[model samples]
Target: MLLSLPNWIIHLSSALEWGIAAALLFHYGKITGRRDIRLFGLAMLPHWSGSFFVLGYHISGDTIPILLDMSELINLFGSTALLLATLNLLKSTKKTSATSYTAALAAIMIAGKPQSYLGADIFDAILQLSSVVYITFLVLLLKVWRRDRTIFSGLTVAGFWFVLIFISVTIFCMYLATVVRGYPTLSHDDLLHGLAESLLSISNLMIAIGAHRKIREYKREQLNAIQG
Candidate 1:
């Protein structure tokens, strides 16, 4: 594997953290009796699965470009799933047609992207489309927060959006690695690669911690109610 032991640990931790976050969110839904939230947690699975494809690509020493492409494609679907799940939550609060809104936003987001054979350009387009979907999901999340903060803590919502920071930093680090340091890829530079990936771990940790706190608070509230 091209990744060092520490780098593998970072990657593994990120995937595990995301899984924990999803599980916590699902548990939160179970306790609160919110099917939409549960669906949201389930929607996170595709992204988690995509992460494994990433690990597989790394394990192949980045030789299997197809694995990376599959990861991107799966991530695009994951982003769409997340967006739809959030829209379902919003539907409970507003009478708006979630399907219609999702369709329109998806159309707009996908219209300009150049479709081509499965290669760098195609993968990049998929990444861009996924980013748009995720951003839309974040916007809807904020709206959901406005309607109901009890479903998720503010920190949890913030953590979801904080992924943008990880993306931005990773891009910058890739530039530094390839362009500045003359490394062929970010993975070629262990220190900078680990630094960039660690941001993902931090963001995932925030998400898990926030969900756990909310779960604890919800249980306490339930206890007080029962006692009273």
Candidate 2:
């Protein structure tokens, strides 16, 4: 019963956190008037939309593969959307390189087989490697905020690092349990995936905080200009 509680919460909150993230990013985009941010917000919806199918998949058992495949598709789409959003924020030739790499990885993930288990699969590997893109996005955002001397830069950076840690630990646990231990069960991967889902809530919360920080900074800048 104890072990089941967090799993239930994580499963349910996966959709909730994603919905909240969408709302926050949409609000942030509107406030900042950034098209890229708005697109990112739009991308968030499909990420968690698979939760419905996941719940059904569990209830109906593994007889159906479509639901599982849907989840993988959603994951690929969300990541691709994030990559596009990140590239949109930049005005450099590097954007093309980033686009190529991100598109290639996303294509690979999309073309991968559905992995319902913790075993080695192209899908799982692509998902793990996609973390590099996420980390890069956060780092670039942090640099932008740093240059602007935004009050939220430090907190944003902290949040980014926390996400990195969470993903790394989750991946390590997955490998240790599945590959090293030679266990056939998905016990470890399931637990870590749940934990990662919860961490996503924290990550989105950080974004909301950054949105508020942006507002505060804008006000300060306006006041200083008026005073001058």
Candidate 3:
């Protein structure tokens, strides 16, 4: 089966995103006096790691003995990291306490095999709930931006765009996977999955860039203040 343009684009984009993310982390370190941004960067690491795992599975055609056993472990850890990152970001603004609690609950629900026994409906519900939480966080961030536009301007812009892309793609894919499952056929599955992955990769890159830029701006401001 030949890969479509979108799939190819996303694949290449993901590979590049990893590099961009690394650079952004370095820049973030330079700007922020706090080391906590490292946590955010670490949270994003699993997405790329999962990408590699899937890629390896596709290429090998045979499941790795250890990986098969560890798949659930990987998923749980990765999902938890993502959820924590989302919560941490919200916490930064000191808003959305309810959303943070909901996110935490959802993460706990996902820790076990709820999806395996409850089926797609349950999984979809969790995902939808998460989507709402993230959306709310996005709104809160925008409100913050309105108040103090320069506080974390670069990071905020990048984070907003990244979250927007993520939420858009996630909702679309969830709908397709649930409502339109049979219409497009199986071939479309691979293409959609690849496209979704690519979008997430781009989102991560944008966030990293934004965070890096914010850090630089913060440092410049601090330096100027010190001199004055």
* Candidate 2 local lDDT, residue 76: 59
| Candidate 1: clashing pairs of residues | none
Candidate 3 lDDT over 47-127, as tens digits, reads 556556544544453345344324434544555565566455555656446365665565755764454444354444444
Candidate 2 positional error at 151, Å = 11
Write one digit per residue (lDDT tens) for candidate 2, span 42-128.
Answer: 866766676677666655544565676677656656665665665565433232344555565556545553343233665554455
Instruction: For residue 90, give model 1's deviation from the true position in Å.
Output: 0.1
- TM-scores of the candidates are 0.93, 0.61, 0.56
Q: Candidate 2: give the clashing pairs.
A: none
Worst 10 residues of 3 by lDDT: 61-70
State each model's CA lDDT, in order. 0.90, 0.59, 0.56
Best by lDDT: 1
**What lDDT score goes with residue 131 in model 2?**
51
